[model samples]
Target: MDGKKALYYAAIAIAVLIGVGIVISVISALVTLVSTVISAAISLAVLAGIVYVAYKAGSWLLGSDDSPSMDSIGSGSSTSVDAGTSRQDRLRQQYVEGQISEAEFERRIGEELETEEIDDIDRELERER
Candidate 1:
């Protein structure tokens, strides 16, 4: 029992030491980063602006405007994966493109009709189209 308790205490002490080490390392890195940014010719704030522009441009080129960003966090957004396209439309497309057999398309459409989530407006639009 004493041996087990000693092992447990030693393990806890090691964990605490590791946590302290991590905290110290993070503080040292932050201090270094701030100092380097302050000592540079251009301001750190300007560097942050360049980084933000590069990030937005990269996202635009990749055609993913909905990537996680502070701008979108509080905004109302689309609830579905494909906002304008329905599952039935996609399944029909697959069949027409020869990606799926007609039987597979039928199976998928049935499954989508039974198991898919569609808002009333989307369902009405799909029917109209």
Candidate 2:
């Protein structure tokens, strides 16, 4: 009867030890998962920051200067040939001065022509109305 009692106590102790080990293992796994998630988040944030900085730097480096606004294209101040000079002339000057690429100059000229046309059409519509 005493031996039976000893065996029953040993069984309970083993069961308790196993339960504690399982709990510790589960806790460890959860901690590892959390750490991994945090690491990945930090890495992604750093990458995003780098990309943003690069984008800003590229824009600053490649941005044009003092170019005429689209809104000024069809205005009286923009279309004058002598004092203000036409937008096309300004774009050509910029191209000649190496401030803008030939392609950019051509594109801006096309835009100016389109804006002028649109403005004329709008004026005609207003007159009709």
Candidate 3:
């Protein structure tokens, strides 16, 4: 009877140890997963920052002047020209400077007129809405 009791006690101890070991393993796996997720998020944020900086640097270095900056918005500046007028002015300038032929200027003007008509239609739709 004493030997049987001792054997039963040993079996309970082994089961308890196995349960503790499984709990520890699960905790470690959860910790490792959380750490990996944090690392990946940090890596992605750094990559995005680098890409944005590179894009700004490239734009600055290449002298891209067509896009309006925040400073130019609502400043009531006389230099600000609408897209249709700007295109027409640029085409006329090129033609006067002999950079483009009369045929090319006329073709571009026709395209600009078509675009302006579409824009007018869009504005009318918005007004109706």
Candidate 4:
């Protein structure tokens, strides 16, 4: 009877493993399908942009100014186009200019990260309050 009970448990375990495998296979197939669809959509969008740009160039050559402006092609924000220095960019610039030692630059960046984290936490606390 004990041997029979052991076989029963082993069979149950095998069945459960098979069921899990089937579920994983189905989920993987679904994810692959979704990824393919997204890729196709992005490809179509890029192709459309290229065609539109070509049409605009043709129109411009024929003496028309109906093409979208450069701002429309990229981020239209003036602030983003300005000489803004990110933390990493500033660190690199300082190191390159001999204004800071490598170790000091790293330390400053680490401190900046900590400060940003603290600021984020404070902001969240304020929001909650």
State the C-alpha lDDT per candidate. 0.76, 0.80, 0.86, 0.79
Return whichever of 3 and 4 wins on lDDT: 3
TM-score of 4: 0.49
Ranking by lDDT: 3, 2, 4, 1
When summed lDDT is taken over every stretch of 10 residues in candidate 3, the lowest stretch is 75-84
lDDT string for model 4 (55-98, tens) is 88888888677545565467433332232236668888999999
| Candidate 3 residue-wise lDDT at 72 | 60
Output the TM-score of candidate 1: 0.32
List ranges where model 3 is wrong by over 4 Å: 65-75, 82-129
Model 2: per-residue Cα lDDT over 35-109, one tens digit each: 999999999999999998898777666874345546667776344433324567888889999999988988988
What are the clashing pairs of model 1?
Answer: none
Given candidate 3, what's the lDDT at residue 3? Answer: 100
Number of clashes in model 4? 0
Q: Flag clash pairs in model 2.
A: none
Which residue runs does candidate 1 get wrong by more than 4 Å?
Answer: 41-129
Candidate 3, 1-129: lDDT as tens digits: 999999999999999999999999999999999999999999999999999889888887797845676666775332333757888999999999999999999999999998888877777797799
Q: Which sequence of candidate numbers ranks them by TM-score, best first?
A: 3, 2, 4, 1
The residue pairs that clash in candidate 4, if any, are none
